[model samples]
Target: MIFHGMTVRQKALDLLDSGANGADVARRLNVPRGTVSYWLHMERSKRNICPGTRTPSCHRCDGVGLAGADYVYLLGLYLGDGHISQPTQHRVPSMMITLDDCWPGIQDEAGAAIHKVFPDNATCRVRKPGCRNIKVYSKHLLCLFPQHGPRRKHEREIALEVWQQELVDANPWPFVRGLVHSDGCRIINWTTRMVGGVRKRYEYPRYWFTNVSDDIRQLYTDTLDKLGIKWTHCTRAGKEYNISVARRASVALMDAHVGPKY
Candidate 1:
């Protein structure tokens, strides 16, 4: 009647396999319900009966609706600086976004967005030399982020699927906000002018998004076009890798929605 260690665990699992619930198995074996539940979970894991496989948690695979706004934001973060990796030791793939340590608010927002997009997964923060990497593990990362591939984002072509495009269209500001938070910045450029025989300084505020990938830059500019935000390509050091939003109206619109990274 009394079991110990693995013996009790095996007995609990056997009861569970026989269609008895955790509570019933615990009552019959005189073990705590929590302990019985733990045993069941471990047994399921051992048999590879994970929740991802059993219940279909992935929105894409299960045909369930995604957290659209959060997903679009995360997609921007992913396109800008996120990386997805599947380590040999891990059962699932992880998506990580590296953000500067100075911007804890942006870090928090990225973490919150990841959590909201994949509510069932766990997220962690890893600190590097001068930045923090926000990471989340999920089996369906590739399913959600179809742009993930073997090559670096800049080295490969990046395009959105029809569903993803629809989501971005529906929530343009959040998408822009995500990209800005990841790889864009609002800065001030100044010039000197003579007014009334006196030298005066004038400041102009603008938003700049710099990315080496032509496709990604095109995507950013295309989204801006939809929002009626005018952007110009800026060539730095003979390379055109920056998109500048300097028009008064466009800058005002960006300030109202995206603003500077906090």
Candidate 2:
């Protein structure tokens, strides 16, 4: 009756079959109990089968939509609490990353496994001996390694030693290393960043400027206007400015907040 579109009564009668009980089957199959009874009544009268309501399953998500929308999340863990530098934090042990920082080529096999399996919006609570909860944005479900770095074994020596030496070397004046710190007291260092998209086998320098520069002069003037850094630029004594987190920004993620480096 359903296929041939013969009669409504016949279609209804056929809904109940096999060992299925009338009431339970009616509710499970989303048909009214009265309808199931009526169909049976009509079926007894006409002695035929009946069809029932039709429903389509969600093919896209296969019903996983009950949980959340499809997406990936990245969580950053720090060695110490980041709150000492910033006010409060949300979603402890996690920092949010914007989508643009991720590219398809970035994920490794291990990272892809998490992205494919972990539930969207599922929390990653970092609870390790030295773990710190510091979240950052990652569109590709990956955390950026600390660029303020000494955390990584290989870069431990280089981040502090080489970067410090480079920045001090950039200056014309001889400056003591240990005494050097930004106005906020974060250690002074050079940060290198390679320019993107060029086929050259070389990369550009990416480090903090520990010395005077025309760009930094403009920046100090601009920032001083806002933060009221009391000072005067003199042609006689010389131009010097404190490098501090309260002063300026850097291109490096960790150092981005570690500048006024003039």
Candidate 3:
């Protein structure tokens, strides 16, 4: 019996009963062939009766209570700049979100959000040539993010489920925060004006969310509107659109819910 491992003993026994060879079971479970062979000859009922290693958080694999601030926020990040891939003949299902290497703060927040959503599974950070990646494996994500199919975000229609919509309705800040932090920026805007016959420079703060996907941009703006955080949208170079929150009170409002990443 393989102890302290993720392999489901009972499931392995069932696979063996289904006429799969020990090697095949081992390959599927990513375990040693001897481990599969040992479990195949043992007591399936006794092993199942012992206890399950699954924790409360792993329940998300089956699509339980997956609606909340964390869930919505993760969804936002995914929609903004995340990718999900199905298992190949030799791989497991995985989801990845890559961020610019320069932004360690955003990377840390993304890692924490992924861990919060999939607490049962372990997530790892990988460094690519110019970006950092947060990757995790979970087949259950296929059910949660149905919009995770072919093509880029702009080429796809991004829509949320009724439950997800309700979650955003109740807690829109985290959702917007995730979207903005992933694909937006907060910076100072300076302008020159004439005051008392002298030219003076003034500075103000603004939040800008830019995305290539119109549907996603709409979703981002819709959520901002829901929270009553006033913003303006304008077309940027290429197919991108920029949504700006520059009003004094509006900037203050966003600052409360979503501050600088670092």
Candidate 4:
């Protein structure tokens, strides 16, 4: 490896590599016979004659990239021994993961379904008393669920929200349903608005719950009082606030009112 330390020899060797013969190198350097040969042999050997060394990250031969040996060495580099840290739970790479690839418990459930439909294939085709259509098309039943490819980000967001909505709707209690609906719907207070840009009193004017039903409103009020929600109840009867300010105040009231029903 000390052969790497000799700049002149290395240069000569490089020139040699670029089709410069031994005689050409000898002629250029004006060296006698066998001196270049000795240098070449010294390069081939692993003796540490020079102080410095070429610490190339290779397990195979140095100073010369031999045919296919270099390739094997490269392969060793490619397939390294470095260990990867495992996650606390099973972790999948994101890119290759489609909906089908990451279908939470789908595969096992599908397999069970398949097995249920098609128990012991040998007996089933003989048309026993319990030979249902499922038994006839066992393979078809096994592969019944179609392969759903990767949904894009927007699709996934929509799917998740839809799933959540479905879950909420499926709940037995009316209060829970109202709470879920409230979560989805925006709040609006009964407030006044200037009619057609005129500098006068707002056309629509009142203070009532926007989205919530009567029972929901009552429930909200009761929950808020229990949770000590500082809601903006009318201390003054005829107080006029700007539209934006009123909307914000309404939101605050709603937040305090709908503290944490879920």
TM-score, prediction 1: 0.84
Name model 2 segments beyond 4 Å from true. 1-119, 130-139, 142-262
Ranked by TM-score, top first = 1, 3, 4, 2
lDDT by residue for model 3 over 17-68, one digit each (tens)?
Answer: 6778778888887888877765653453344321111323333344455537
lDDT for residue 230 in candidate 1, whole number 0-100: 92
Best by TM-score: 1
Question: Which candidate has the top score in lDDT?
Answer: 1
- Give the Å error, residue 44, model 1: 5.1
lDDT, model 3, position 20: 82
**223-244: candidate 2 lDDT, tens digit per residue:** 4334333334434345443333
lDDT of 1 by residue, 124-149 (tens): 99989999999988878999999998
TM-score of each: 0.84, 0.16, 0.77, 0.17
Q: Ten-residue segment with the worst summed lDDT in candidate 1?
A: 47-56
Residue lDDT tens for model 4, 69-160: 22221111111110112223422111111112232232232233323322322112122242211112211211211111234222321111
- The stretch of ten residues in a row with the least summed lDDT in candidate 4 is 74-83
C-alpha displacement of 174 in model 3, angstroms? 0.7
1 or 2, which is superior by lDDT?
1
